[model samples]
Target: MEFMDHLHSHSGLLRLVPRRPFPVTIAPMQWYRLEFHMANELGTLLPSTFNLSDIHVECSLLDKSPAALSSHWHIDWQLLLQQGAWDSEPSLQIQFLIRPINTSLPPHLPAHLMVMVSPTYDGDNSFYMLPLITAPFCLTSKRQTANNLVPNNRAWSNYVTQHMYRGFSLPCFDQRYFLIRESWVHGTPGKLWDSALVISDALARQLLPLNLTRPLKVLDLSAGTGVIGLLLAFIGQHQNNTMLDITLTDVPEALSLIHDNRCLNKITYPRLSVAPLRWGIDKDIQAIQAKGPFDVIIASDVLYEPIKFQDLVKTLDKLTTPSTQTWIGYKRRGLKLEEEQSFFTLCHPRFQILDRSLDENVIHCFGWLGPHAPTLTTSLPPCLPHRVTGVQIFHLSKNSPQS
Candidate 1:
């Protein structure tokens, strides 16, 4: 079977890496490399195991349209997939137009440049896949040296209804999940995750029934970028059978992202709400608990650190009643077997754990079939362990009231 035919996570993604520092001077000639590399679902580069053809590149100024830099720079497409080896350093030679092309950019101010690569696949209804963009680099003058890369914030992850949400195959409604970029620190709660997508898929297919007696109440804990809650809201709004009332909560810093995404999607009060929730904090737990004993509570990729496990369990205990259905989607990074087991151990006292990770209903990868997908895709970062990643689904509920 095709890997994508049964996948639940993204196969692989493309990334543009700069060879070195970018404060280049307007000398006789300047060389800067905007190299292309394929990354696994974990964002680590993979050796050229997949062939990527018919791909497009956009090298342009960050603040201006790609066309604005056309006269100023000429770039060629030298993608990593073109080179069939892992050791090959495939660099594209970007020609510099010593002179400024656009009058809008003042010569006194160095222009910023970013490279974006998008792939066009071969299929029945093939469309341009998600584009991977590089962090902006400063185009400086001969005398300039210092650098301040622009803060990478907010990007839209477009999802066609049929492509992402099998249940959400609404012809008119598509989803644009707002992400805080994948360049976040490990366990940072602001970026989109494969586990979250897995959870989303599970909710759409297995958990949420195709009929609603009451607005199915949902609580998303540690809701980074609010993907789960937002997705539930979108689904409920579109599919009458699955109408939902969702509350997305996270730490203070991460809450703004949820709010922005909420505003970005034009999702407002009643259908969805945003709140600042810090796990283990008594006041925070009390404030959120008042809202639920929710019908369903979703938490994905939150079992990250051992130090935070107790707190997360505490929060879950506070919000769930005997009837609440809690779903957790977890992907282990470098944690030991016992370390991961510790989480379930902590929950043993308050909840009943049903590990359906091995079940056929679970979607191991995202519902996008990217280049080469499972067969040729690999996790190639030497610093990191060389193993493919997978998400585990844990269905938890309060133990029998008698106990």
Candidate 2:
């Protein structure tokens, strides 16, 4: 099948566009443009009907504490959000110049601009649309920046709650939880993926049909961004499901992202579990098995590497028992159908494919209203949104019952 060639899912997700060849220096009282754009996720760039008036734009210090921010200098810029200016079509991006206003040069130095939806605005409460600050930059002053302090990862706060999820027919947890992600520049594990969104929403919807009277155990394999297991954990809490035994696994390199995301969501032990897992590692599989037999196992976009097909299948065969319901969400970007079938071909008698479906329109409404409104726009690599397919879901279970 024809698939879209996109760098990453930025659609519906707001981003502070990185300036090409990042500026070497930022001077105070000089106008530097900060362009905030929502990257495209699905094949389509969703429009933003978000009221312009509700959004706020300003500059912020890179390493200053939230408490310290209130006492220090303040910088204000054009908010760009106007009544008829942008609300007519509702753009996905806004840019304004930010310059220090106060008399202080800031011994710590002001380094980034913040684009946030005002706390007072009662607009769509989706986490994907939460505010974003630009990546840290250099200040003109000779003084050290960030006071030589920079956190490993930048945190974006999205205070959406479980109540917001009740209404969507096909909703994935938006900024509903205070979830955070590392940029691809940092590592791919932390960035959100469209497949994760589509699959999690699909699985969550399927769980609702069970009425969830009993305990539920879940596994999110290759749980980048921790979106899948995290969402289920929230759902489990809402359902009052016992134990809240949700575990997320990925490579060691990827574990920190999952850990950070899980923490930012305020989910803790007994409620959420994160472990380092490599698909073919026997030790990892056995360690994870001790926590099993899961009621449902879920994964997204793990089939991208054709060479690793056997390893992933092997891991699935060992982790799942006859009753374990497995869901795998795959995006066929630039992959041949045969390449995908090859993965299922490896499962053989060890597992059975129960059902398969596609989320053709998982979120067609969530378009990116950026430089190319009604079209794809991102600071990431190029792709065509029209050719993107809804993620493909694979439901599986052990072929025979186990003792």
Candidate 3:
């Protein structure tokens, strides 16, 4: 029975990795090719036990297009069992080609590719859709080879991403825009984190009434592109009474972009700076403390990986003071419940968790006007909530007196 399970393992799940890194851009009216290798882990152990029935590959542009173009924009390939047993080998190599088309596709759009395989044996039927690739790319005027470009090199370039927030900062301003440079092209700062928006919104509302007259010191841990920190700075500027001195910290690879984003925003009212800090490192902790204890710490989407959970908790322990307020926004990705519980368990010893339930205070704080209102004139457009889900915001503070 165990041997049969081994043979069928390749049928239910496909082990696929991108042959090349993300952001694979290509030109319009030119042929584009993509290559990938499929893992055949069990083929050697039980080659005769199962048979490969079919293989299917698909590529499509996810962005909205004209009805005529959108309907035919996708490319697909299907292969049958008569094509021979391609799965008998230890690994299978596949390539896809996109033929030239007349449509004028815009630049900076993302193309998604998915592959599924079906295998049958001993009168059993099953299919596997193991690997899905989302490569955010654009159609350009000039042709280029997709595989030649390295994903990591683009991370240091001037790739900019923009985010808009409603009813942020001053009540008079209906909306605000933030331009961020993504240091990691594979979608660290490259992607806009929804949790960042929710946490920033909640923080602004909760702190508005406090009205601290003095300059408020703030820190953003794992601050990808410094979105939350930048929002807090904007809030401080609008509050008139509180000045927010902001420090944005992340891995060394991300600091270059964080500094560039701070400059792009033209922020001057509240001093903004960047630091490179690896979580749980003693020297890094001491360097951050040189700026003194922060009044508020903001983090978002930093707890996705389980291995880093302990280090993150230690970093938080080092940064929090008696009066420090910490706000965290997390989106639960399936399969990490243990990591989430473990994080809170470690945090329970030193910090008290504030209730995360969304009430009228949190909702009204959005100040979203009706959909009929002008884009920039409304605090927030009504449609924002529809796009937000599966996210929770937590507020925490030290339970004991500061040493």
Task: Say which candidate scores most in lDDT.
Answer: 1
Reference-based lDDT, each prediction: 0.55, 0.53, 0.52
Q: Candidate 2 overall Cα lDDT vs. reference?
A: 0.53
The TM-score, computed over Cα atoms with residue i paired to residue i, of candidate 2 is 0.58
Worst 10 residues of 3 by lDDT: 160-169
Better-scoring candidate (lDDT), 1 or 3: 1
Instruction: Write one digit per residue (lDDT tens) for candidate 3, span 1-403.
Output: 6655433443332333333343345544454343343432221232343344344443333231110123324443333223213443433333333333435654343332222222212223332222332333454445344444555757622232111112122343332333333333535754345566556656666776546768778888888767778766655655554466788899888777666655655555447778888999989989998886898888787877778878988999999988998888776544346768988998898899875635445432332221121232354432233112345667888888652
Which stretches of model 2 miss by more than 4 angstroms?
1-33, 37-177, 205-211, 237-243, 359-389, 401-403
lDDT: the better of candidates 2 and 3:
2
Relative to the true structure, candidate 3 reaches a TM of: 0.53
Q: Which runs of model 3 end up more than 4 angstroms from their true locations?
A: 1-171, 174-176, 181-186, 205-211, 237-242, 363-387, 401-403
Clashing pairs in 1: 8-365, 8-366, 9-365, 9-366
Ranking by lDDT: 1, 2, 3
RMSD of 3: 12.4
Runs off by more than 4 Å, candidate 1:
1-37, 47-187, 206-210, 240-242, 368-388
Per-candidate TM equals 0.60, 0.58, 0.53
What lDDT tens digits, residue by residue, belong to model 1 across residues 1-403?
Answer: 3433223133333333333333322221244443344444444543334444444443333222221223464334443334424456543333333335455663544554443343443431222233444434445654543222233562222110001110112112332222223324324675566677567655655534456777678999888867778766755654554457788898887877667656544554456778888989999999888877699898988887899999999999989999999989888566668999999999998999998776655654332222222222455211101122366778999987789
Q: Write the per-residue lDDT of candidate 2 for residues 27-129, one digit (tens) a residue.
A: 5555544433333432233344435455444333322112112233345555453332434433323333344445545434545322232111234433233
The Cα error of candidate 1 at residue 218, in Å, is 0.6
Clashing pairs in 3: 108-138
